[model samples]
Each structure stands twice: as C-alpha cells, then as structure tokens.
Target: MIELLTPNEMQLADRLTIDSGIDGYALMQRAGEAVSQTIVAQWPDTKIVAVLCGTGSNGGDGYITARLLKVAGYQVTCFTAGRSAPQSYSERAQRDYVADEGVIMPLETFKADEFQLIIDALLGTGLTRNVEGKIAACIDEVNSCNKPVCAIDLPSGVSGKSGQPMGIAVKADLTVTFFRKKPGHVLQPGRALCGVIRLCDIGIEAEVLEQIKPILFESWPNLWGALLPDHNPDSNKFRRGHVAVFCGNVWSTGAARLSATGAARSGAGLVTVVAPENALTVLASHLTSIMIEPLGNDTEKLDTDVLSFFKRRKVKAAVLGPGFGDQERAKRLVYTVLQSKTEDSDLKTLVLDADAITAFKDHPLVLFAAIEKSGLQLVITPHEGEFQRLFGNFVKGKDKVEQAREAARLSHSIVIYKGADTVIAAPDGRAVINGNGNVLLATAGSGDVLTGIIASFCAQGMPVFAAACAAVWMHAETAECFEELSPAGMMAEDISQMLLKVWARLREMATPSPSPST
Candidate 1:
C-alpha cells in the first residue's frame, strides 16, 4: 500500500521535518537539484530552457534550478510572476541565482517558442483556488506552446488532494515529485496531465507517516496479501465458504450466472444462485458447478426462502441487484437480506450492486438505517449515475476519492465507487484508489462479475476493506490478461475463466523471490 497524502497532510510532514532540526533551505536545494538533474538527463541535447517561477516556494525551487542549469552550461531564461518579499526563501533563492550570473525576467516577458524546454514551478501542491491573472496566462501559454514540460512536484492548478483542475492546469511531459506520490499524480484529469511521474527522494523520510497517520492509500497486492485466505489439505468445501448470488429474472439470468461463476472461480467452495421459481430450470441448465435455489415472487415468500437458505446452508456472503429489472422487488430483497441472520458467526456480509443500489435512490436514508440496524457487514458498488441517484450532488465538485469517502461515512458501509479509477472507501476514513482498470471492463455484465468476486472474498472471511481492494484489482487485471491471449473483444463469462490465471499471478506476486547465494 503506497501512502497517498492530502495537501494538508504533506504540509504537516514538511513542518515536522523542519521542527526536528532539518534545514528548510537545504530541503529546498535538494528538491531543486532533483528537478534540474531530471531535466538534464531526459533532454541533454536541448541548449535552451525556460524556468517559470511564481511568488511561492515553488518559485524558490525554480530559482535554484535556474542557477544549477546555468552552471551546467545550459542557456536558461528565468521568469518570475511576482517579486519575492525581502529576507524570504524565495528572495534568497533569487539573489543566489542573480549572483551566479543568471538573469531573472518578469513572467510577462516569457516566450513559449523561444525555449526548447519548459519548467513549471509556478504553483505546487498548496494551490486551493483557480489560477488567474498573470499566473493563469503563463499556464495557458505553456500548455499552448507544446514544448517539453518538466513540472516540479505537481503541475500548476491541479489539486494535490482531489486531482481536479483549478480552472486550468499544465500538461507536463515529465513530472518530478518528492518522497511519495500525492493523489493528484495518480487520480484522473491530473493523472492524464502528468504524462510520466518521477519520484525523487529528497531529505524527507517515510517514517514521518507514523506521526501523520495517513488514511488514504494507492492499492497494490501488498495492501491485502497477508489477509487473503488460503486452502489446505484439511479444508473441506463447506469450510472454505458459501456464497449466494440473487438472480434477476428468467429472461435476464445471465448476469447472476456471471457472478456465480466468478465466485466459484475466486475460491468460494460453494457457490449458489437464488433464482425466481420460473428461472430455476434455465439457471440449472446453464450452471454445472454452481447450485440453484428457488425464490418466491412476493416479498413474504422471498423472506421465507432467504431465511431458510441461511438457516440450512450457513451462507457466508450474499450478492444482490445485478440485472434485476424490477426495482421494487430488488429493494424488498435488499431489505430481506439485511434482516437475515446466520448461525455460522455473529455477523453476515451482504453486497449490493447495480439495480440494488438504484432501488434505494428514493429514500436512501431508510436503506442506511436498515443496514446499520441489522449489523450486517455491507458493501455497496455504485457507478457515477447510481451514486448520483443515491447520494445526490452535495459532493458534486469534489474528486472521486472525497465523494466515495463521504458516501461510506453516510451509509455505514464500504463504498466502492466503480470507475476507470475505482475508489474503495471504508467507514473509518481509510480509502484506496485502484489504478489497474481500463476500457476493456466497460462491457455488458462486467460489474456483475465484480459483484460475485467481492462476495467470494467476503465469504472466505477476508477483511472487508482488504477484500474490496483485492476484488477490484483482480477484476480489472483479469481483463488485461485476457486481452493478451484473446485480443479480440471479451465477454462477461470470459472474465470468470481468466480469474484462474489472475489468481495464480497474484500468488506469484505475493511470494518472495529467492535471494542469490554464494
């Protein structure tokens, strides 16, 4: 789990390092040198370079870079947006650059086409508001120039915390950041702007995270590998876990079938689909390994069948809502599933997806209350539209991470905001951003497969947040692996078959490679 810091959190870390006796000026010098070295290494032939500086410390780094680049025999044009106050770091840096025979000009004098390379130090991670006036103009010019851009820390105008642009942002060919990555470097529009991210280790130590106690993370196998369940010779079918998937309708049983197949492939010892009475024969014919259970058409009948299944089978996890055409019936089943109890343990897990999420849009608060009262470990998978329907636009302008975090807090469940950059947020403020997904996962019934994989993990008793992160990574990565073998398009069923290779790959990744010996 690579830690991703918010802007405020990074600020605290810097302050702590300074308070503990590290020189702030020394830190700034190392930062500048990193940027300068990267620029020189990536473009050694380029003789002309433009360093765009602003009023803040980001500009201070730019001043130092200009001085270093001058010493390195490069033709440097240094531009400052505003005058630095006297006796400050920015002023000190400017004076040092001038003493080294490096000339500083106003930002208005900057010419985009005059230089072969551009250095963006106008704004750093601290930017909260939109770029305006001269700074905005400089950014616009830099972007329009189409010159090779090297950004210090982050591109100007992109939010370090949420990754959203503040009016406009610099599109950099290379971005040199320090210590660790901010959310902006990995999150979407900002991610697209930062073409290639280079993490340069300055003087700041990663140990400071202990004091910072960051809750956000970038998902990787290390985050959940230790918590994953493994089967041994003594394990039995019932001992591994039992997963139950609810069917949509006779005409639309494919979605549930995809989910059930996914669960079975994910190491769920027993996978079953609870189907409508009319769809039992269809589901049975299609499914060989997965079992089938007949569900009643009405609310009372569904409640009875659902409770009976739990009582007899000791089901560990249940999935609902994929391809469910009737919203009202889906909502009723969700409520019934919430009220379900199992004798296997004190707690039962439930996953809601697609139609199930939309069914609660009219009165989301009621659904939240029911989940809370039932004491079920709940996870809700909602795309942007389903999220808007259930959570409204109160979080309209915030980035995907913040919106998902808020939704988790409100619903008292782990919120999986499904997207190309999927965000998994736990109720306690812990969050993970999944970066492995692609357009290949945009096909029909893809999310249904994801729902089953998550259920399988929960059934196996993997921790909730860890289960969600693992499930999301597996779902996207399986698609990527499938494309390598069958580059032609893939279907929802194909993903389930690919899960075997993905699981083996995960186990390989989790295993430590043997060290070379004498």
Candidate 2:
C-alpha cells in the first residue's frame, strides 16, 4: 500500500535526510530543478513565467524554480510576501539567487496575466493557517486571472491532512508533489481544484512509506488482488460458499433476483432467493441458474420460517435488503434475518442496503445495538439520502470521504458510502477511495449489484474489511468497462455480465505473466 503523508510527517522525512548528512540546500535545488523541468515540458512555447514566493522554505523552492525557468529562456518574475529573509539554509540559497540575477517584484506591484503560467510557490506542506492579508489578495488575483496555474508541493492554502481549504487556496491546473501523493490530492474540493496530479521523486527513499503508515489508500487492483477467493481444481459447489437472499413482495421481487444473479456471477457457488409464496412463480420463471425458495406471506410466519430454512440449508452468508419495503413488516423481516443463528454458531455475515437502511431511519441506535449484540460482521451500504436517514446529519459541509470515515467510526461497521467516488471505511481505521467507477454506474439497481458482490466476498471467507474494499473496487471497475454505454436504459443485469469481464481482467493481473511453452 502507498503512504500519504501529512504536512508534519513530510517535515519529519526532510529532517531524517538532513540528519543523514545531505545538505538541506542541495535537497531544495533538486526539488526546484525537478519543478523547472516539469514546467518546460508542459509549457515549452511559453516565454513568460511568474513564481510567487512565500516567507519560508517554499519561497526558497520558488526562487530556485524561477532561476531554472529563466535559464531555459523564459522571462521569470519573482514576487515575495514578507520583508525579512527566512533563516533556513535553503531559504538563504534562494535569497542569494535573487540577489545575483533574479528580478524580485513586490507583491502589490505585480499584475495578473503578465505571465502565461503562474507557478504558486507561496505555501507548501508547512502551512497550517488560513490565507490572510496580502497573501489572500495574491491568491485571489491568481484565481481571477483564469490562467493555468501549477502548484508546488500542495495547493497554497489547502490542508495536506484534511483536504480542507484554509480560508482560501490557490486552485492549480496541476499540482506537482514529491514521492507519494497526499490526501488533499485525492479528497474533494482540493481534488477538484488540483486539475491533474504529478508525483516527482527527489531522492526520498521509497522505504519512507513504511514509516508513514497511512490509514487511507487509493484503491486499485493491486490492493485487492490477493483477497479474491481461489477456485481449486478439486473445489466442490459447497466448498465455494452459498449466499441466501430474501425477496420482497411480487412487484418488488426483481431486486432480490438481481442480487442473487449478481452474487452467482461474482463467484458465489450457489445463490438462493427466498421469495414470498405469491411471487415464487414469477421469480422462478425469471431465474434459471438461481434456485427459488418459497417464503410465507405473513411477516410472523416468514420470520419464523426463515431461521429454520437458514439453519437447515447451512447457508454460509445472507443478504437482506434491496427492495425489502421500508414498512413495519420489512423491519420485522430485517430483525428476524439479523436474529437468525445456528445451533453451534452465530450468523457470521449480513449485508444491509436500499430500503433496509431506510427502515432504521428514526432508530439508528437499534442498528448499532444489533451489531454489538450479534458479534457478527455487519456491512451497510447507503447513498447520500439513505445515509442521512440512517445516520442522521453527521455531515454538514465536509467532503464525502471524511463523512464516510466518521460514519464508519460511529456505527462501528464497514460503511460503504456509495457515489461516483465510493469510499469504504472499516471500523479498524482502514479506508479506501475508489477511483475506477464512472457516472455510468449511477443507474438503478447498480447498488444492488454491489450489495451482492460484498455478500459473495463474505461467504467466500474473506474478512469484512478486505471484502468491503475488494467488492467496492470490483464494482467500480465493472462500471468503468462500459463507460461508453449510457446508464440511462441499462438495467442491473448489465452490471452482472460486466462483472465477469472485470473478474477476467483482475484475475489476469493476479496471475504471473505466462512463459513461452516448451
């Protein structure tokens, strides 16, 4: 897993290098030269460049980049915010460079649009406060210019740890950070402002990532490759795992059937849909590979019968949600499903989504209590509206990732905050931001597909934390495959077919590259 450093942690890395006998000034030069190289590559025809310098080491980086950009035949204009020079070694080098040949323009005298590309070096990772006074005005000017801006290290006023904009921040066209990326580069607002990201290595040891130990990760196939279940040559149907799903009424049975198909397609050995007796005929006619079980029509009868059926079949895992109505009957059904237990063991896994999450809107504590009492794995998938109904209004204006993390901690369950950028958070502090999914997944029944995938992963003996992350990544990757296909007319079944394609691609990456046949 890659590490994303906070501002202070990144400073620790610099201190570590200085302690190892490398001169701080030499490190600054390398960083600045690398930034200069990036500028030329991106803007080869540009003859004018403006570098905004601050009062510290970030200013030093600006001076050096200015000198290097000047050497490459661009007219470089350097601007400084404070009067006194910084005391650091790198700062002294930057001051000396300006004294020799660079044109130091006062902040008030500099005009916007004088340069085609603005390089914002006003603040780096060291900044902890909001932008104010002349600095705020300068950032405002940059924002009003409408020209492309490249930020060094991080955007001028965004927090590296939280991705929050401090008062105001420089919205950059591209943000060139060193080594591994930071949270701000991926989190919202900051992520939206940072048009594109480029990570540069300036002699920082790759091993430094181990010491950082970031709790959040950018989700990719590499992270979930090994978590997928292995299908052995001798594997039997029972050995692979079975997932049982509860269907709603006749009109609402499609969701349950879709989920069963999704589970079956996602590698579940067997998927059974328990439908109300009235809906069994229609469901049976619709499903070929999935088995259909008859459920009693009345809530009390169904509740009593479900437990017996689950125990008799020795079902490995169960999915209860989807189109299950948000009424009292649905609530009773959900409670009965949660209470289902075996003679020798507890129900190890349960997935809740759709109307199931909505049913517990006024009494979220009941959901929490259920989790505490069961000592079983509980996974909740909620969209923004459902999230508000179930978890209350925990998120005010915070980014979705932060909101999801907080929800995961509060509920003490794996929280799948579903959206274009799905964030899955475990109670154990691990979180992932999925980048693979596109708007094509915004269609109806897509989430039901995801619900089935997670249920399948849990049935296959994968831990809830890993299963949640792997399932989310796979769901998103599947949607990305059909990016060109509009989500407008598509149904849930399309995503199940796409899952097979996603599985093939992921499996290829997991397997070792083939060698030539003898």
Candidate 3:
C-alpha cells in the first residue's frame, strides 16, 4: 500500500494478475462491486446516481457498476460518450448486464443537476494527453454539480504516473482504487481532487510486487516511525545530538529561530541558532531552550565557528538558508560549512534551505562540487520558486517526483521539493511523496519549521532520506491534528509548540497496545 505505482506499472500489475489465472472480467467485476459498495456505504440515502462511462475498460467498470446498482434497487442512470464498444471484459460485462433498453443513455442526454451522486468511469490511468472535447465538457459539468462523486481507480482525466489533470479532470469526493495506490492518489491537484480515497483489495495478489520494483513511495509514519530517535531513560541532552541552525541578520532572525525551536521540540538534545553578531539579540529574546551562537557573515569566521563546533561539541547537523539574505554571504557560508568536517564525529550532514538554495543559482555546479567533496550528507529544501531559481528548468517537463530526483542527482544531495505534494527525493533514485499536507501549511515560515525538524532528525542519527520522510510526515501530521483540534489558523511558530502532541502520538503508535487478558 505504501508503494505508489506508475500507470505502466499498474498495467503490468493487472497483466500479472490476469496471467496468474484471475479472469480480467473478474477483476473489472470486483472493481465495479467495490465502487458500488463504497458509494452505497457513503451515501445510503442517495437514490438518483449518474454513471459516466467511456469506451475503454473504465467504461466497462461503469457499465457493470450501473447494472449492479440497478439490481441493488438504486436509481442509476448510465451515460456513455463511448465511441467504440467497451474494451476486453467490459464488452462482455455490457452485453451481459446492460441489455435493458433506455438503461444506458448517450452522454449528451445526461443532466448533472438531477443526480444525487456521480461516478466518473470515463477515463482511467492511461491518459497522457490533455482532456478535450465532449469528455472535458462532461468533467466541467460534474465539477459544477457539487454532488458526491465516486471515481473508479482514479478520477478520470488524471495521469496515474504524474497526477497532472489531463487538461481537465474529475473532482471526486471519493476515489475507490484497487490493490495499490497510483502516484495520482498521492501527488497534488490530483491528490486534492481525490477526496477520501478508499483502497480495496480486488483480488490483485501482493506477491506480484516481487518482480516489480516500485520507485515511488508514500511518506507516512510507517516508513520512518521505527527510525524515531531512541532516547535512553538516562540519556542527557548531549546523547540526543546537537543541531545548529544558521540565521540571517536581525530583521530576518525569526525564520532561523523557528527552525531552532522546531529542532528542540522534535527531541534534539541541544539546538543552537548561529546568528551574525547583530542578530544575536533578536534570537536570544525568542529562544530559551535553544542556544544562540554569534558568528560573523565573513567566510573565515563561519569556517572557524563551524569547524570549532564540529571539533569541540558534537554538532551533528547544521542548517543554513532559512532567511539568510545576502546571496554572496550565504554562498560563502555554505562553502565554508561544506568544507568543515570531522571524520570521527557526526558532522557529516549539512541542510540548506531557502536562501541557501538560491545562493547557488549562478554556479550550482560549484555547490554540487562542494557537496560531493565534503563527504557530508547534504539535504536541500526548496519550494518550486526556489528550485526553479536554482535549477532553471533542469527538469522542465518532468513531474514533481522526477524533478526532485533529477535535482538530487545533479546536486549530489537529498532534495525536499516543497509544495502541498512534498517530494523528498534522494540521489539514488529513491523518493517518497507526502500526501497529508493541506493548504493550512502554506503559511509563512512553515517550511522553516520543516527544515528544523529535518535537521533535528539528522542530528538524532536517522539516515538523511528517512529523516526527510519522517520530518515531512510529522509536519503534515501536526497540521492534520491541528485542524482537528484548534484549527483557528496555524503559523510556523505555532507548529513548534504543537510538536509535543504529535510526538506523543508517534510514540503511542509505535508502542503496541497490551494484549487483553483472556
């Protein structure tokens, strides 16, 4: 369930299932049955339903669902814009169940406003081109209806590989997908549109995954929960690991402080905000558990302070580029930190975000070289704008996951491409797409908080890739819990204070519930 398959992979999975002797028609029948069951369960009172069926296998699913619903005594109207007969088992399904006259109507004859529910079976995961023509009009009308929608597999007109709407796509209230999820179910826009997804086991066996190595994964607690920092009962601050978040000047110190607080809240043994001499006051005023270190913006001072920290203290990870302004100084400091390291210590990690990423736009290769030679694990958090500023269409036509992966390969670092659909991609072609984040996380400084959590996890000894996934999942989890509780509105600073809530929940989930006394 964690592994996200591309459209091609999904097809292969289906073919594998079929080859394993499961009837292809049986698979469609199962899909249709699941869709009908989910729809009935979700909207028990709704009697009038519109089912849009295309000419492909997807249309077959709809035709079967329509017939099943009709038998179930629900008023189901089947409409088709199908140019040709249904494909494969769908043709059989239509011939067997949809023989009643006036049961399946032309697509043009259907009216969206009259339906209490809608099922989008017009398209499946195979779409690569943009949606146009009659189907586009149908999607637009369905979106406007505001009725509950249940989409088969994924919403029609969405690419299972990329999650981009094929021009226009169905906005489903409920998406009933079979077996494993596709990328479209997790990647954004499509993710948002696929509301309340319910994955059903439609006879696709799990053993087929042995031959198929899925590249994309869904980021959630299950992936990194065990990797959560193990703090011994007698462990002190030093045992947890120390993290330093480098700050900009006084006016922009808030971002750095937010990151530092995030680190401290996320169980870092010690957290420090490395600020310039002038920014110390601002940082000191806001931070208590997190310490503040003063360093000059000059490269020499940065090198000395960072190298000294690595030598004297156990500085596990250092963060740069939350709000660090001057590009020249950010560049100089990044290079300085990249070059400072200790072989025996946990000083093999550096995290760059915001200004740190943009600082390397002019000569990204230089930064990449520094990362490659430093022998330090590098993690960069950049939103689309920051990413574009640095890579400049390096992955112009690629999807978010691909874009992040390519950037990571080129930069020789872990890339957290931030957005509603956050993609954490490593240079080794491994990636996890975060699906829980909502618009509430778009507030200012939210990413800074995420950066802090990432640095904190790295300091606490998690592998960089797992740490990134853990941090992203925790950030989204916090937002989700917040929405459930207070939800008045959340800010970056508020996230740090709320970490304890999810942290406790994380520990609870990891701990097994006691077996009931028999």
Candidate 4:
C-alpha cells in the first residue's frame, strides 16, 4: 500500500527521522536542491523569476530555490509575506539564503505581468487556518496575474488533510510535491488547484512510512489483483457463481433486471431475478436469459423456503435493495438474506442499493451489526443525497475522499460515493479517484448501472473492497470509451451492454505475453 500522509503527520514523520540521527537541515538541503533542479529541467526558458516566500519551511524552500536560480543566471526577485524568520532548521536555510543580495520586498512591489514564472513557496502544508490579510491578497494577485506559477511541495492555502481550500489557494500551472502525494493532491478542488503535479524523491526513505503507518492508500490494480476471479476451461454455471437480484413491485422492477443482466454479463454463469409475484409476469415478458423467481404470498416476511430453492441451486451472491420499494417486506427481505451467516451459507456477498440504502438511512447501526453477523463482505452504493440520508451529516467533510473514508468507517462496508467524480472507499483505508469517467455518465439511472457492475464483480468472488474498486475503474473507463454518445440520453441498460467491452479491454491490458510474431 502506498501511504498518503496529512501535513501534520508528515511533520511528525520528519521529526521521527530527526530523532533517529538524521539532521533536519540535511533534508531541507536535499529538498531545496531537488526543487531547483526540477525547475531548470521543467522550464529552462524562464527569463524573469518571482519567488514568493512565507514565514514557514515552505518559504525557506522558496528562498533556497530562488538563490539557486539566481546563481544559474536567471534574474530572481524574492518577495516575502513581511514576517519574521522561522526558528526551525528548514526555515533557517531559506532565511540565510535570502540574507545575501535577495530582494526582501512585500507582495505589492511585484507586478504579476512582469514575471514569466512565479514560484509560490508561501504557506506550505502546515497551515490549518484560513488565508488572511496580505497572504490572501497575494493569492488574489497570483490568480489574477494568469502567469505560469509553479508551487513548491503543495499549492498554498489548500489543506493537506482534506482537499478544501483555506479561504483561497494558489492555482498553479504545475505543482512539484515531494515524496508521496497527499490526499489533497488526488481529491477534488486540491487536485484541480495542483495543476500537472510532479512527485520528486527528496531522500525521505520509504522505510520511514513503516513507523508512521499511514491509514490512507491510493487505489490501483496492484491492490486488487489477487481478488480478481480465475476461471477454468471446465468451469460450470454453479462452479463459477450464481447471483439473485431482488426486484421491486411493477414500477420499480427494472433496476433489479438491470442488475441481473449486469451480473450475467460480468461472468456470473447463472443470474436470476426475484420479482414480487405481481411483477413476475411483466418481468418475464422482457427478460430472456435471466430467469424470474416469484416472491412467496407471505408478503410481510420473505419466504426462507423459497429463497432456499436458489440456495439449493448453489447461489453464491445476492443483490438486494436496487429497485425494491422501501416497504415493510423489502426491509424484511434485507434482514432475511443477511441472517445466513455461516461460512457454508449460499449468500457470501451482499450489495445494498437504492431502496435498501433508504431503509437503513434512519438507523444505519442496524445494518452494520447485520453485516458483521452475516460474516459476508458488504457493499453499499449511495449517491450524495442517499449517502447523507443513510449516514447523516457525519459523512460530510471538506473533501470527497475524507467524506467517503468517514462513511466507510461508519458503515463498516465499502462505500461507493457516486458522482461525476465517483470515489470508492473501503474500511481498510484504500480509495480510488476514478479518472476515466466522463460527464456523459451524469444521467439518471447511471448509478443503478454502477451498482449492478459492482454486484457482478462481487458475485465472481472479488472481495467487496476490491470489487468496488474494479467496478468503479471499469465503469468510468467505459463512459470515457463512449464519449461521443449522449450522456443525457444514456440509460442503465446501455452500461449493461458496455460491460463486456470494458472487461475485454481490461483483460488485454493486464496480460503481458510476447506480441504476436508478425
């Protein structure tokens, strides 16, 4: 797992190294030199360089970089926030560099139009408060200047803990961050503010992460590879996996069939839709390959006997709550499916969506215990409104990553926080910022398609944690593939059809055999 550290945690990590015999000043020297070299390499044609420095270590880094740039024959002027020098070794290095020949002018003295490149070293990761006074004014100047700006470490005024901007932040043309990328670097507004981020190794040994034990990890294929299901040539329908999607009453039954179709396409050899008796006839008229099972007459309680019929046929996964109405019986069925907790139980993976999520919104704690008792990995797909309804405002945070992480922790299940920038967070502190999806996915019922995609992967025995990641990645990639298609007109069924193409692409990309002998 690649660890992502908060600004405070990063400071503690640096402190830990200092106490372990490495001098802090040595790290600062290496950091400054690294930035200086990176600037020369990335933008050698710089005529005038304006370096902005604050009172902290970030300012120190800028001072050193400016001094190095000056020595390299580029005209450099240093602008300070008109604050005293920092006492730390990191701050001292920057302060000493500016003591000789570097102009110590206020932000007003520099005109944005005058410089070709502006290096922002103001207010690094440690800032926790909102930008104020001259700092805020300088940020406005940088934004208004429209000149190409390169930020050191992270863009100023963006919180490292969450991706939220502290009142205002510097929008950089490029951000050169050291070591690991922070949560801000990948999450929302921070990701946008940090333009074209380049991660440089500033000699912070990877081993130091072991002591800090960062709980957050960037999601990627490396983490989910083992969870990908392996299929044999001799695999039979039951041998692979069987999934049952529960449909709601007539008006709501389509979502369940969509899930069934998605599951069937996603490698589940046998996919069934359990529709309410009234809707069974209507469902049968549309669904061909998917078989429909009618619910028992005992409407108040889900018929365990009827469910056992599928169990006897060796159903391995179940998707509930998609189109199911938020009725008393729907709630009962959710509890019934989760009651089978034994290792040999037919249901090993459960996907809760739409109405199922609505049922638990009033009391999420009820589902958490049921999930633990069921001993099955659980996945919950909720849009922002549904998410807030289920988990309350506690899940709301400054960054989508933070909110999703909080939701995963509270629910004890994988939380697929659906949006144009969908984020999937697992309880184990792993998340993926889906980059492949396009605006075309913003249409209605798209989330239903996403829920089905994840359910299909879960049925194939992908751990709920990894299945969510794979589903999100594939879902987004599929949307990007069909960019020309009208997003406004796209429906859930369209995604069901596209799943196969996305999986084939993923398979081809993952396989590393010698190219065909041409």
Better of 1 and 2 by lDDT: 1
* Candidate 3 lDDT over residue span 372-396, tens digit each: 9888899999998999988765888
- lDDT scores of the candidates, listed in order: 0.87, 0.78, 0.84, 0.76
Model 4, span 134-217: residue lDDT tens: 889888999998788999988999988677799999999899888887877766678789888888787777778878777665
- Please name the candidate that would achieve the greatest lDDT relative to the true structure: 1
Question: What would the per-residue lDDT of candidate 2 be over residues 36-143, giving only the tens digit for each residue?
Answer: 999899989977888888877787888888888888899989888865464775467566767768888888766777888899988877567788989899999999
Which 10 consecutive positions of candidate 4 have the poorest summed lDDT?
A: 509-518
Candidate 4 error regions (>4 Å): 16-23, 84-87, 342-344, 393-406, 420-436, 484-491, 494-501, 508-518
Instruction: Report the C-alpha lDDT of model 1 over 1-518, residue by residue, as the tens digit.
Output: 27888888988888888998998888889999998999889999997999999888889999998899998899998999988878888888988999988988889989999999999999989888988998888899999986899999999999998788999999999999988789998888888888899988878987798898888888777777767787778999887899999898899999999999989988899999988888999998898989998887776577777787887888999999998878999998888788775323322789999899999888999998998888899999999899999987457776788899889988999999998788999888888988775678889999999999999999988888888998999999987898787766888888988898888888788633211100
Task: State, as a TM-score between 0 and 1, how close model 3 is to the true structure.
Answer: 0.94
Between prediction 2 and prediction 3, which has the larger TM-score?
Answer: 3
3 or 4, which is superior by TM-score?
Answer: 3
TM per prediction: 0.94, 0.89, 0.94, 0.87
RMSD of each: 3.7, 4.3, 3.7, 4.6
- Stretches of model 3 off by over 4 angstroms after superposition: 83-87, 100-102, 297-301, 342-345, 510-518
